[model samples]
Target chain A: MKKKVLTKEDILHLAKLSNLKLSDEEIEKYLKQLEETVEYVKNLDELKTDKVSPTSQTTNLTDVYFADGETNERGLKLKEKYFIVKRIM
Target chain B: MNLHGKSLLELKQLVIEKKISEKELNQYFLKRIRKFNPKLNAFITVLENNQLGIPYGAKDMFCTKGIRTTAASKVLDNFVPPYESTVTKKLQEAGMSVLGKTNMDAWAHGASTETSDYGVSKNPWDNKRYPGGSSGGSAAAISAYLVPAAIGTDTGGSIRHPSAWCGVIGLKPTYGRVSRYGVIAMGSSWDCPGPMTLNVEDNAYLLKQIAGKDKYDATSSSIAVQDYTNEIKKNKKFKIGIAESYFAGIDDQIKKHVYKSIDVLKKLGHAVKPIKLLPPKYSISVYTILQRAEVSSNLGRYDGIRYGNDRNFFGQEAKRRIMLGTYTLSYGYYDAFYKNAQKVRSIIIENFKSVFKDVDLIVGPNTPVTALNIGEFEKYPFYGELMDQLNEPASTAGIPDLSIPVGLDSNNLPIGFQIMGNYFEEANILNLAYQFEKETDFFGVIKKGINNYKD
Candidate 1:
């Protein structure tokens, strides 16, 4: 497998997808480091994993429950609810 | 007399025995922090409110209601959480007083606290060198005797690396063995909250307090939490394995000192033998893919809304990792990179399972070398990741790994004797570490005080 080199455009697209804006210098830094990182990770391709099962997490739990929402003293319903972000106009 | 050299477990006992009030204990640690923190840069925040008990420092990443939880990032610098983390809450419930928040790698991304937006946490031993991190500040606090113990979260050697460098005890409990509830997420599956302390007994006692299931975190283990304190006191002997591969890339002095510690274990009635183990380098690749993927996804929630500043608030290390993660988990590359890494993760876990079948625990060096001087990242961009090479496999496998002082290198930097046990085998590892600690005097040697820090 040919190791993929991450181009500046690739990183720019990644930054966009990741919701991050990068400066020209940051882009240059990522270009070199990310390219090297990708190359290093290419070693995974060497192992034959066609029949292997992926271990995304070791916990093996499913259907995690969250508490029911209730209105706090502030008159807003709360319970696992994150702070509301300002809407982008 | 100053309480700086005492173990937290010992201090807690004194508090219970009425030898000292919790308020007095708090004052002793608070005074030490005030004196040493300017030199060590170990603390991010020092709380004024005091409670009577064993004072424990928390890594800034763990959310504490009304107190700042920065995760050492500029994004969350002003953010004060409305709730406490489950682990810290348990500590509070168990009578451990919160001293303050310690420094860490920004978002716990890098191994060194140098990545923290606040300031680099200095090594307590040698001010010129790094304290080894993401949990560097926690380890440094314990090393400097600012606090007897501190809570640290480890994903890829965050707790263990700094423990090794700072010359203290670092225990990375089995994944899910401790709750992640209210912890600022970095890698969801891999992040584990553990203890860094001056002695093994304190590490065990602290683990006992925090290890249990939590309704808030579904990933937390439902397994029965062991009486780790009592477990450590039990006399036990078993087979110990030392893998040649774990020592391959480390410095000669570290390798030599670790072997000397292994010999101490042998003298204590445990059989030590060389065992064939999987190449840990493979874990570097898997950890790189999964951690980066998770980092990108986890940090996605930071949009200057509910908590921190916008995406623009990330540091270079965080952005670098985020970009790489986004690229790897991107549409076309998902199967080849992200999926393949997970598949390989199973192989790494299987490798540990096979090894654990023969040995009660595996022993090795915690890092490739002792803590390097600052500016290491400039010379080698991957210094943190590469330094963590030996310890990452056990982490990726979700097993418990403990690092204790083996000996010091030629430069006087500490070498760590790493003992990795099977999943849910934290007590086994702690027992061996405790036995080793009882037999050795390395802990006292380190506490003699660094020559450079003027008292």
Candidate 2:
């Protein structure tokens, strides 16, 4: 199996998608770590999983909606509800 | 026995017989935590109160109302929860008091407690070594007799791995068998809250108090909770399966102890057989993918909106996982990485299911090696992940596994095995472990570390 080698650009793109800002040193460090992690995961290709069904969750659960009210004490603050971000317009 | 050295059952009996007051028991442990926590670094927050009945150290991952639940991360360093987790609330109802929030790997991301932002928890047996984590604080506290037992969350060997290294009993119950409400989420499908204790009876006693369904958690199982204490008292011999492939690459000293444990079981009249199991290496890959992907998704809520600090509070390990998760779940790599890992997960589950058809339980080493020296993480960057090689399969399969101390190594550090049962069959795991505990002196050996246990 060809190992998955993550490039520098790939790490930057992932950081953007993950809403994280990285320094140049961090990018270099993560590029090496992410590449190694991806290489380790590529071992999955060795197994013949053509016919196996994917297991997203072990239990049967769906549509987990809470009641409409101020019931959750762990809720977001008023300013947090709109989520003011420095970059997001 | 002194109050701190008694098992959960023994202490409960003391409470019943009026031999010791709850306030006295509470003060006794609180004093111990104050005296020993600075040395062990086992507790992130020590609550000094006079509450009753088997005071347990709860891993900071579980939210306690009005108490800071940090998950050992600076992000939530001062984040006090407004609501209590279902498991803790259930335990409180059954008279278990909270000693404090124990330390863990920040965000429960690493195998060693070294990743904890608060500081590392030292092994109770040897202060120079790590206690094993991300539940190291709870395991360390139990090992040091600071708390009789503690609640810990296991995603990929978080509970069992640390407990094994710390020389205690850690039981990771079947996923969904215990509620995850208010507990910090790492891998939604893989995270399970279980007990870390000095003996199997306490493990079973704690499980009975905290295991059940709750409307607050959709994933909580509706299957009735068994009388696990009664179940453990039974003396049924089981057909145990030993997978040679699982034992390969393990330390020779640890392997010798595991084989000796198997010999003891055979002498007790249980039929022991060698069975081929799914390769654990593949589960490691699958676990890496699924856990990171879920972590990326679950951690999205920590954007400094409702709670804690900004996302910048995430440690380097957390950032690494998030980046890996983002890349794997990206448009091009989803099928090749994320989807493929899940399919492999299905295969791993099927492999365990098939093996259980021939035998009631599976046994193997809990960790690849014993407790590591505190600075070993810097020497080997991937130390945590590689150590969990033996535990990933059962964790990914979401089966109940108990880590019990089988014996000690050359350095007197503990070595243990993983006892796994079929889904929702924690009773079988507990029964077998209880019988082993009765026959062996491993549990008693740990008690010798207690300072004031009156014979």
Candidate 3:
């Protein structure tokens, strides 16, 4: 398996996608750490998984249902049955 | 009025007989917490006025209604949950009071609680050493008798790792055996909320109270919960598998203690057979990729729009995990990383399924080594994953496993022996652990840990 070399730009892009603002030090640190982590995980490539199906969850159950209902109580800060959030626009 | 070294069941018995009032018991633990918390840093939030029932520490991951629940991160430092988690609710209903919300790694991201935004939790045995983590504080608190027991969620090795290091019994029940509702998410597919206690009986007692299905958590199992307390008493011989792969690279002292434990099991008339298991190193990669991916997704909820501080409050470790997750799940890399990891996770699960056909349970050392120095985590980039290599296979396979103190190492740090069972087989895991506890009394490891903080 060819190892992916993680560069500073890749780290910054990932940080952006992850909604994190990394300091210059953090970027440099993650660049090295993330590279090492990525390299380590590539060992999975050694296994032949061609015939196996991915297990997104272990429960082996699908389409589990619950009675549809709504309670007035919620953990979020709410106003008039709507969550209050900072305006993005 | 010395309550030191008393198990949860013993304390309950005392309360029932009116030997000690519940109020006095709560106060006893409260005073201990106040006295030792400054030095140990085990708890993030201590409830001084909690006078409801028998007090136990809850890993800060569980949401307690009207009480602050932080996953040891600054982001949720002020986030008091409006509703209670199912596990805590069940424990509360079973007459357990929340003494405090214990500290953990930030978002349960690291094995060492040094990643905690609040502070690192020290090992009760040696303050210079780390109590193995994400559930480090819970394990530390239980070990030091700050609390009789605690509930900790294990994603990869969060509960068992710390329990091993702190010389306490920690069970990571089968995935979905306990509801995930109201617990802070980390590796959603692998997360299992379980008990950390000073004895196997208390661990079974707590698991009986907390294990079962919940409507709110879709992944929770529909299988009937077993009467684990009674189940532990039944005399049964198990076919235990000794996997050489699990012992590979384990410390020499740890190997000696674990093998001694296996010999004890053999003496108990249980058959021990050598079995081949897939090298645990493969599960490490599967766990790292899949867990990081799940973490990135689970943490997406913390936009600061509804609860917790903004993404800016994420710790360095959390950021690093999120970035790697994003990189893997990003365009063009999903197939090479995320999807492939899932396929390998399937292989690991199948591997355990096949091994269980020949054995009732698999036993081995819990961690590769004993408790490490506080600052040793910085030496490795993926220190938690490496430390948790043996534990990840069970986590990935969604099986039940327990960690019990076998003996102390040369440094006086605790060595842990693990017994892993088939899916939803917590009863079997607890039974073997209970039998071992009766035979060896865990070599007085738990007693020594509590005596370290004797009043």
Candidate 4:
């Protein structure tokens, strides 16, 4: 697996996108630190992952215990409106 | 009369038995807060100032109507919530007093509390050394005897690690064990709020009061929590398992103290067995990756547009996670990094499952290093990176973990042992710690250099 080296420009763009207004002093320091962290994460590319279906969840969790529109006994009864857990599938 | 070093169990006993009133104890902490919090930087907002008139939980991170909820970030520095967290409501109903809110890493990012926009929380033991973070404020306050107990959230050892550095007890309950409805989110999946206290029994007792099902959190488990305090009292003889893998190359001073304590456990009619838990090295990588990935998702709400100061709001550390997480979860890199890490996480969980079959409980040296100086990690954003090495293994598996101060080092800083239990088996872990507390005055260790502490 080829290691993806993050260029200085790439680091700056990411930093900007993340809304990190890096001072002149922080740029050089973060360039190297971010490079190391990026490389640390990029090391995962060495693993074989072709056949696997990407899963974003650790468990196959469902709200079977606590049904929607109908509340269970966990203080949801205290208020008329409650926020539902939005599952991102 | 000496409240600074009293355990929660001891303090609660005094409160319940009328030896001391809860109001009096609350007043004592309120006085200490006024005296020392200025020097310690342990609080950001200190809602209700000294006391909650009635007693509100401190921690500016917790949202309460008319109270500021900064999450320690300057972005949402003035933001206050219209509602209170379930824990706070429960504490209010129980007549528990909240001294004042403690400080932390802005947005719960670092290991030491230095990242807080407010200022660093000084270790109560030695003002020079740091109290661990992002829950450092809570740990420092509890350790300094400002408050008998306080609540902090744990994600990648935030609660437990801080407790160890400050020489107190910290608990990270099973994932989804506590509701995350009101507390600001750090890493959504891993964020869990638990207690930090002066001893194991106090942590256990507070945990019982807070642990329950929450309807707001779909991830919150429906399992019933046992009376953890009572569970600790049963079965004097216990099967305590020690992690040989985690101990392989820990600092000799900490390793020596842990093993010596194991000897004491053996003498107490309990069996300490060497268990083959997975090596802890990859967990740092695995956890940092997963938590960063969740950081991308969880912190997205803080666009400074809707929530916190998105533009100039977060600290350097928060920005680092946002960039790292967004990069990892970006268009092309998901499979190798984020996806593969979860599989590795599964393998780690499987290892925990296999080990639990043989050992009744698991133990290891809690942190790779003890309390460090305030500015130690100023150059590097990841403060105390090595100490985080051992904590993530159990955290990734969603198992309950406890860190208790076992003894002090040559420098007299507290050394802690991390104990883990089967998923949702916090009662057993508390029992083992309670038994150890009975045998040794574990909470008896004093803040050695307090008289000479400096700003």
Candidate 5:
């Protein structure tokens, strides 16, 4: 597997996707750090996981369901069954 | 009456015998917190009032109803949880009160609490060094006797690493053993809430209170919770395995202390055998990718509209992780990074399952080295993963593991020896640790830690 080389543009794209606003200094810092992390994680390629299935959760549980008609307050501001939010144009 | 150097059980006994009222005991710890917390920065918030039950520190990651849960991040500095975490509720019902919200790495992202927005938690053993973290504050508070015990959640070595560095007992219970309903999610698949205490018995006792299925957390197991405090007294002999791969690249002093602990286990009639397991380096890769992916997903809910400060308040470490996760989970890259890491996680789980078929438990040095000095994380790009190399395997496998103080390094820092057990076998893990504690008293490491903070 070839290593994925991250670039400044890639950092910007990721920052936009993650809803984060990074300064010029942070972009430069992350370019180097994220590249290092991505490179380090490349070691996983050494294992052949083609035949194996991905484990989403460890407990061998299926169809875990909460009992019906159970409700708890979220503690957010509410008025007459409607949540209040900032007005947007 | 002086309550210094007393164990949780001792304090409970005092209250039962009327030697000290619970209110007085809480005041005693509050006085100590006022004195030591300034220097150690172990707590982000201290509850000076409401002294009705036995007091203990809670890692800031666990949400307490009507109390601030910062998670050591500026983003959530003012965010108070409206409902209680199952762990804290269980502890409170078990006659424990929350003393304070202890500091942690922001969003539980780093190994050292240096990343905490509230400031770093200094090691109780050496003020100049870090208390290994993101559970650093919990470990430090227990080490300094600021609180009798603390509850910390471990995604990957957050509890054991700090416990090792702070010379305390920390157990990372098998995934799904403890409810994670209100814990600020880091790695949802890997997050485990467990106990950090001054002694093995306290660790067992706390686990008994918090370990069980919860209707709130779907992943929590339905396995029967054992009376761990009683189970440890059985004095069962375990077949312990020492993996050489865990020792590779470890500090010489830590290796020596772990071997010495193995010798003590041997003296106590437990069998020790050499076993081959997957190298820890592989788990580091799997942990980093999967954890980052989870962090990105979890943090997405924290828009300023819902709660917490805006995204701009995220620290450098959290931003770096979130960006990496976004990149990996992007349209084209998900199969390569996120899915592959999960596959590797399954492989690691199978590796542990196979090894446990022959041995009852695995023991080794918990951290590669003792607690490092403050400001040392800058040298390594992936400092937490490297610091937690020996710990990530059990975490990745979702098995229970415990770290107990073995001895101190030449610098007078604590070294931790960890025992890894098969899935849902905390009783067995606590049994061996209890036996060793009875035989060696953790080399007086826990006692010496409290002696440094004499009132």
Candidate 6:
């Protein structure tokens, strides 16, 4: 998968949606700060996990019995992933 | 009646024993506010007409029904919530008096209160220095002994950072330990409201009153509230881990004072060891993205169409964060920013978890620097980044971290001790902090006086 790299214009567009009217002098500050932040976060992008299952919850609840079985947000997890994929794609 | 230097617990005791009346305390404090607030600028609005006639607590971001919860942002300058925040309700019910509203960074965006539109909160220690912030006003008011204690919300160290710099006690309870309802939403996933006091006992008592379940906040955990005051009174010496990189980037004088404070603990017979915790560099990086993302979304409630009454509503910093957050969480940039930050957040949490395995608690400076000149961040806004250096890590990990005044510097400004505990180990954290407080009466020395000023 080719990773999506964010451009300065992307931040500007997002900034607009956020209601921040950036001055011409300020675009570069966000770019540099966000870039430094993004570069640091790139470490997460480098992780290789071919053999290990990713951790979801910190606690071990491999088995549990519930009468009502609250499955509301749990099922939405699948829907959310699908939606996220479609949106990101 | 004038108990300016008393900690919250001491004040409560004094009030309960009838040594002081609430009216007298309130009048003294209201008088102090009138006397010194001109110099300190610690308040956004002091509701002198509230007719409450008492020294009630106030955190700048927490909603107080009818009093205004502007979050020190121009965005909320005129916006007032119709209801009281859960914590405020609890405090009011507990007979805590309302002094008035303090100021903060607009919607709690920046670490220094500089982001606030209402104006800056200066340190009571030296009016020129920062009181530490987004809870800078609460910290300043409390450190100046104006109120002795005030509720402060910690989102990425708003409470603890300022508490540290201001030479007071501030606690960031474990994630979900305190209710988030009524706090003007800043960063929900990371926001946990706590107290800034002049002592460990006061912090614990405040935590006891504030920590509990709330149906209003579904993410709030169903945890049993432990009496932290009693717990601290009967605690053992703890094995504390020294966080490696947290103290690394700090300036030399601060490093010297912190190390000497640790030596005091070492002499007290606790096993202290050097531990390689998560490199703290990721805290601000992860927090910045997540905070901006959340701020953008949560503040959408403040659209001129909804919360704000006028189209000209919203303050400058609130606007900046909303715009920044919205931009980051927007189309084409969501994954590039928010989701990526979340994944990195996972890594940061994992790093801290790995450290907690070996250590019962971690210790470090609350911020890289102690306190700064008021409004310094306004000129060099990037300096705010340096302020939350040690704060964001503990806050992001959602663990309990307490800051206590360690000692003052050559310039007479106070330095603080920060102790991070494993999840739900606030008992141990508070205990260790209490023991450290006992070792040196440094806090008492801090309150030598904020003497009455004549205008």
Whole-model lDDT for model 5 versus the true structure?
Answer: 0.91
Candidate 5 reference-contact recovery = 0.87
| Model 1 Cα shift for residue B348 (angstroms) | 0.6
Worst 10 residues of 5 chain B by lDDT: B376-385
Model 1 chain B scores worst on lDDT over the 10 consecutive residues at B446-455
lDDT of 3 by residue, B1-455 (tens): 67888889999999999999999999999999999999999999999898879999999999999999989999997899989999998988998899999999999988889999999999999999999889999999999999999999999999999999999999999999999999999999999999999888899999999989888888998899999999999998999999888888899999999999999999999999998889998989988888898899989889998888899899888887888888889999999999999999899888889989999999999999898899998785586679998899999999999999999988999999899999988899999988998999999999998988987
Superior candidate under lDDT, 3 versus 6: 3
Candidate 4 residues lying further than 4 Å off, grouped into runs, are A1-4, A16-20, A23-27, A41-60, A68-89, B1-23, B48-57, B378-382, B446-455
lDDT string, candidate 1, B349-415, tens digits: 8888898889899999899888889877667646468888887998899999998887877787888
Ordered from best to worst DockQ, the candidate numbers read 5, 3, 1, 2, 4, 6
DockQ winner: 5
Instruction: For residues B1-455, write the lDDT of model 6, one tens digit per residue.
Output: 44656666777788789898777777777887887788888888886754442364577688888887777766677768877788888788787866888877777777777767877777777778777778888888877766767888888888888887777788888877887888888887788888887778888888888888765666566668898889998858767788667777687777887888788888988889988766666667667777877777787676666565442456555555565567566677676667766666666667778878877888877777767776567555443765787888877777788888877778777787788888778888988888888878764535643442321
Q: What TM-score fits each model?
A: 0.94, 0.93, 0.96, 0.89, 0.96, 0.87
Give lDDT: candidate 5, residue B359: 98
Candidate 5, DockQ to 2 decimals? 0.73
Residue B205 of candidate 3: its Cα lDDT?
94
**Tens-digit lDDT track for model 4 on A28-48?**
766666677766554444544
Q: For all candidates in order, state the fraction of native interface contacts they contain.
A: 0.81, 0.76, 0.87, 0.28, 0.87, 0.21
- Model 3, residue B129: distance off in Å is 0.6
Between the candidate structures 2 and 3, which one is better when assessed by TM-score?
Answer: 3
lDDT of candidate 2 over B1-455, digit per residue (tens): 35658777788788878898888888888888888889899999988864766688999999999988999888897799988999899898998889888999999988779889998898888899999988999988888888888999999999999989988899999999999999999999999999988888888988998998766777888889999989999879899999988987899999999989989889889999999997788989999999999999998888888789988888898998998888889998999999999999998988999999999999989888898998887666454698888888998899999999988899988997889999999999999998888889673556755542222
Model 1, C-alpha of B273: deviation from truth (Å): 1.9
Please provide TM-scores computed only on chain A for all of the candidate models, following their numbering.
0.63, 0.62, 0.69, 0.57, 0.71, 0.45
Candidate with more favorable, higher DockQ: 5 or 6:
5
Cα lDDT tens digits, model 1, A1-89, are 86557667898899899988888988888888888888888888888899999997775667766547732332334447765545589
Question: How many clashes does each candidate structure show, in the order listed?
Answer: 4, 0, 0, 5, 0, 11
